[model samples]
Target: MNTLLEQLKNKRLVWQANQQNAIANTDSTGYQELDVALHGGFPQQGVIDIDSAVGIGEIRLLLPALRARQQQTQRQLVFIAAPMQINGEMFAQAGLSLEHILIIQPETPEHALWSAEQCLKSGCCHSVLLWHQQLEVAQAKRLQLAAEQGDALHLLFRHKRQLSMSLPVNLAMKLSPHAQGLSVQITKRKGGWPDNPFQVDMTKAWPTLTRVRHADNVIQLPQSKVS
Candidate 1:
């Protein structure tokens, strides 16, 4: 089977446990503080998870990067969602033309993950976004590693309560949808903590992600230990 979880013959999967932790992605979420905390956004080869109690700011956080990708590549966004019934016009209004986004519907998480793995590894598309409620740790790990292998950025959206410690996600943040704006919780970081957690208010007019301070890129990381 051409599984997304393809095992490298030279490098055994078990060896991954011993390999040092690596950051997955770091593109701008458009939120400077959040991106700083995330050491960019998500790891370069990342399996970023958006665990949302409510998905208000989550959509806004994603829009900037998605739009940037579309703008840079002039290609469609490969979006796979069973429950993500986002209006195409809403995205288009936010700067992404509806025609520039490709929407695919898969039957289940396995199929969705498999499809995302294939698409990402294929090197034909720009990025992939998926929402799956019942994703397992093993499957997530496979996706994480697969995404890294594919050199693709993947956003895994799960319910807030589902964010746990077992998964090796590059970054895991919790989202709270609110009446006025969205509340984000940068719940987990790998090597060290970001300067601070983020609390971004969703902007309405267009694709804008304002930050705590000026939207600067550099973030002072934790002091490395030298022994």
Candidate 2:
């Protein structure tokens, strides 16, 4: 029994909570405040859950980190089942190579997950973004394993309202729109504690996207006369 226990510990199949308090590797998130909250930054390679409403600066918030990963690895960044048409201009503005991006609109949700897994395990992708609304714990575990196998990042984007239970992911965060940028709350992180809600400033990087301090000025044009 003693020898069996030792083997398990050596393989990291078992560990005390206090013993696993820090992640082994991380990449800078580009946002100083967000990076500080996330210890150093996002994990280098693993599954991450981002729960946020679409078109709420969620993609913008991740652009910097994803861009960094793509450049560092010089690998493809694949998108599986994107909700809307991807704008290359936005990616170009963020300094991502347009040629390095591959967008796949899967025919079904199951296919979406399959595509994401393939990209993560291909060893040629730096990151795979999957806009999937439903995911089971088992499925998430499989993706996590695939990410580890290929040393890639798997980003799962879904609405917070759809989440029913905690997922077995490396990191999970909730995002909402804020005047300055995006308000982020760290809900779950492996080897780390949950952090309070904090604002990730986007004004400096994206002045036009951040909310402006101005009163509502309604310009009501005269109603056109109808025949």
Candidate 3:
């Protein structure tokens, strides 16, 4: 009986590996440097955890891909309990359609997690973004599995301090504001070596500098502010 169970487990592992290989697709992240680092772009289905200090250009870095997805599929992009209010006009200026974006403000972190998982599993949205600083490993795994099953893009934004704590994800990166633009450091990735931190000039996507203000070494701007 034990032997049979072991054989079944092995078969399941093999099936999962085959599925992963079959579904893997290379999508460009719109940033040449990041594309080379990630071997294309973000994974089509999995949890992508981004850790960054507040006011960094984390969301700005993803605008291009999000905009492309919005235009390509015409699917709604869902935001669950975002830490800051999204500026629709800013996203619009960046080429993302405000009509295609849906923002959800959950009352609690647990509610946000539950909503995110449900949104991913429902397959109603092309991508789901969740901002929660405190996420348990199990919760992260749940979100990852939900993303995989739904075949949707899932981006989790967390505080930089969470970098010390591990989370189950396909890709993990540390984002910071640099003089040139947004500095992206691949902290974790599957099936490839992480490269050195690279700069992505967000101004290319967003030429309007009305939002972000960098002065005296202090970043003062609204959420999703682009440099």
User: What order do candidates take by TM-score, descending?
Assistant: 2, 3, 1
lDDT per residue (tens digit) for residues 1-227 in model 2? 99999997885455456865767799989899988988899999999999988898888888989988878878999988988889999899889999999999989999998998989998999999999888888899899999999999999998954555877888999999899899999988877777899998898888998877565686768999999
lDDT of 3 by residue, 1-227 (tens): 87977896774321232343322575678888888778778888788988887666778778888887788787779998777778888898878888888999989888999999998988778899988888887888889889877878999988754556767678889887775568888987765545688877666555563245456778677789689
Give the TM-score of each candidate.
0.71, 0.85, 0.79
Where model 1 places Cα greater than 4 Å from the true spot, the runs are 1-25, 163-165, 194-197, 204-227
Q: CA lDDT of each candidate?
A: 0.66, 0.88, 0.79
Evaluated against the true structure, the overall lDDT of model 2 is 0.88
Clashes of each: 7, 0, 0
lDDT of 1: 0.66
Query: What is candidate 2's TM-score against the reference?
Result: 0.85
Judged by TM-score relative to the true structure, which candidate is superior, 1 or 3? 3
lDDT of 1 by residue, 88-162 (tens): 777877788777677889877678889887767766566778887777778877887777777777787778444
Query: Could you tell me which 10 consecutive residues in candidate 1 have the lowest summed lDDT?
Result: 8-17
Kindly report the root-mean-square deviation of model 2 from the true structure over all alpha carbons: 7.0
